[model samples]
Target: MSVYHRPVSNIWWLKRKPYILFMIRELTSVFVAGYCIFLLVLVYKLTQGADAYGNFMVALKLPSSVALHLISLAFVLYHTITWFNLTPKILVLYRGEERIHQGLVAGTFYAVWAVISFMVVWLVLGV
Candidate 1:
């Protein structure tokens, strides 16, 4: 019987730009999940009555919370951008004899995302 051992370095992903970006994209999920949980808590607070919701808003207004939210927003934006860029690879489009350009596919995704996001904001604000 023969035993083989392999060692993995902590900064292995650092060896390549793509690998680092991939790791960052994977880690962005944690921040996204955290933001989702934060929203859920806000919803729970709303259910608890106006006072609870007010308190939660106040807590969120704190500097630390603001910082966390900003950091989370950055991660979410990066995650979204990477996913949008990868869409062409995940979804193939053909124009009869030729395939659509990757940039066009990604641009379409961004346009739709922006439109939907704007609609959501408008609906939420009633403005």
Candidate 2:
């Protein structure tokens, strides 16, 4: 007996709203990873001494680089928001036999994100 295999269409994910959003979230992860690699390269350039690091910073200030960073930031933000929303489902916390509210769970994550972001900004600004 031969096994029957179902053929999947390339645009199958586009058939539904949830599927489309899920695919986009997964796609954004690539941009996030690319940004991480970009940071690693930045660190490597910094270790190469002042001139190399200065040149890297100069390139980053270009319009094309700025646009790419903005686009990546948007995707990364979406990826983060969706993941945070899903955390409540993945992690169910019980409080004295009663389950904690999903909003509170997600809100806690957002609060932590805000605090960390503030800290980073403060450090970057030397304030």
Best by lDDT: 2
User: Which residue runs does candidate 1 get wrong by more than 4 Å?
Assistant: 1-6
Q: Residue 70, candidate 1: how far off, in angstroms?
A: 0.5
lDDT of 1 by residue, 1-127 (tens): 9998889999999999999989999999999999999989988998999998999988988999999999999999999999999999989999998999999999999999999999999998989
Q: How many residue pairs clash in each candidate?
A: 0, 0
Q: Pick by TM-score: which candidate is best?
A: 2
Candidate 1's displacement at residue 47, Å, is 1.6
* lDDT (10s digit) by residue, model 2, range 1-127: 9999999999999999999999999999899998999999999998999999999999998999999999999999999899999999989999999999999999999999999999999998988
| Whole-model alpha-carbon lDDT for candidate 1 | 0.95
List TM-scores for all candidates, in order: 0.89, 0.90
Clashing pairs in 2: none
lDDT of 2: 0.96
